[model samples]
Target: MTLQKVNLQEKFNLFQEQWRPKIVGELNGQHVKLAKLQGPFVWHHHENEDELFLVVKGRLCMELQGQEPIWLEPGEFLVVPRGVEHRPVADEEVHLLLFEPAGTLNTGNVQGERTVENLERI
Candidate 1:
């Protein structure tokens, strides 16, 4: 395989869909994905895996069950523990980098309009 560098801004420019995560790279059974998010997302939890969300641009709000919401700015990241109920909200367009198992669903336990099973690679 040929090794190559990934440019975040360039990768993000390829798609305009919101809530859809595009795979950028993979390693050790995990996928590195990039996505654009806006509005409130459904509440859900991963049954067997933790999810890492890194804010690459704009703001991201992580609402946790039984706790105050956490806000993330560019260069910040949050790891949602497995089985913990949480929802992500973004008032404006937010760019995100996600690190999780290759088969991890965008909507986790709940199958909804936002669930993306077959992720596209950028």
Candidate 2:
């Protein structure tokens, strides 16, 4: 293993696509990912792994089934519990930091257009 700094600004600059998550770091059995999101995402749930989303820039809305959407701004985070159906919607471009198990799929159990089975590290 080697020690190197992971600069968010530099990492974020590596991509421009929306809803695609890029790996930035790994800890324990989890992956620390960065993503740029815009528009609405599919409503799905992780059957086994909990997902964490931290807004880095702009704003995001976490919409859970049967519940009011939770709004998150920069520095705010939300942990979507395993098996809870939810979707993320961003009116504008949003920068986010995501933490989840290494093999956790971006689309959770549902396979759709936004599903990412393999994510590249930046």
Candidate 3:
């Protein structure tokens, strides 16, 4: 078993593909995913689960249904409540860590661009 505290940053570097998330670790039923994002992602939402996003390196813009949206940096995080439509945009290459369920789709509610079907790590 793994006994050391996992460094999310190192795990994120294992994958060089954008939007493709790697299952790094798990905590409290939440699957920790490390992904590098660029460009804009499809607009979607999770109908039954809240998604947590933490920027590990760059900046990200997350637009929610009825809110002003949030811009997160390295130490910033945003918990997108369940059932809310949101879109993520990255002006530059960004490294991020996500907290959601194991089966939760990266695209969430609707499937289109940026949807990763099968995820495998390096």
Tens-digit lDDT track of model 1 for 6-55: 99999999999999999999999999999999999999999998999999
Kindly report which residue pairs in candidate 2 clash with one another: none
Candidate achieving the largest TM-score = 1
By summed lDDT, the worst window of 10 consecutive residues in model 2 runs over 109-118
Regions more than 4 Å wrong, model 1: none
lDDT of 2 by residue, 1-122 (tens): 77999989889999999998999999899999999999999999999999999999999999999999999999999999999999999999999999999999999889978888889988
Candidate 3 Cα lDDT to native:
0.86
TM-score of each: 0.98, 0.97, 0.90
Better of 1 and 3 by lDDT: 1
RMSD of each: 0.6, 0.8, 1.5
Winning candidate number (lDDT): 1
- Candidate 2: where are CA atoms >4 Å away? none
TM-score of 3: 0.90
